[model samples]
Target: MKTFEATARSKSKVDTYISNFMKLHPFAAFLTVFVGGPLFTLLAVAAAVYLIALPLGFIMGWF
Candidate 1:
């Protein structure tokens, strides 16, 4: 009986905490896509440029 009561109280506290967090920072959730999307695209472009340049650089070294 005591264990069940404690569990219920803990769950309620967690629920309240999550609700407060969401209310406080509603935009926090979308921040990942807003920030991460551009960062990932830049890394991809840098990798592509490196890959394309390696072969051309090697071929040019033969000349």
Candidate 2:
């Protein structure tokens, strides 16, 4: 029981530490998504371009 209580307290401390860290460094999370968002958008645009061009390319090549 004592060990369990100790472990729970440590867990809560870790949670509090992380919460404070994030609060102090909110841009850490924002930067992750900000950088990821552009890469994801680029991939989506590439996929869309490939999809759109595939048919056009096929028609142009046939002619």
Candidate 3:
């Protein structure tokens, strides 16, 4: 119960912070969510795949 309350309190704080940020920087938030998110996700996924596969490829003699 204590943990649940703590989690909820922190979550609401974060939600409030984001709400205020979005209100202040609506265009920045829009660009970040719409344009930057997909690009950042793609980059992160590519990096993860590269990091995981590079060693595997060498061990499997596929490289």
The model with the greatest lDDT is 3
Backbone clash count for every predicted candidate, in the order shown:
0, 0, 0
lDDT of 2 by residue, 1-63 (tens): 999999999999999997888788889857756886888899999999999899998989953
Clashing pairs in 2: none
- Of candidates 3 and 1, the better by TM-score: 3
Ranking by lDDT: 3, 2, 1
Cα-based TM-score, every candidate = 0.49, 0.48, 0.84
Count of backbone collisions within predicted model 2? 0
Candidate lDDT (C-alpha), each: 0.84, 0.87, 0.98
lDDT, candidate 3, 30-49, per-residue tens: 99899999999999999999
Determine the C-alpha RMSD for candidate 2 after optimal superposition of all C-alphas. Answer: 9.0
Q: Is candidate 1 or candidate 2 better by lDDT?
A: 2
Give lDDT tens digits, candidate 1, residues 1-63. 999999999999999997888678878745645876788899999999989988898999942
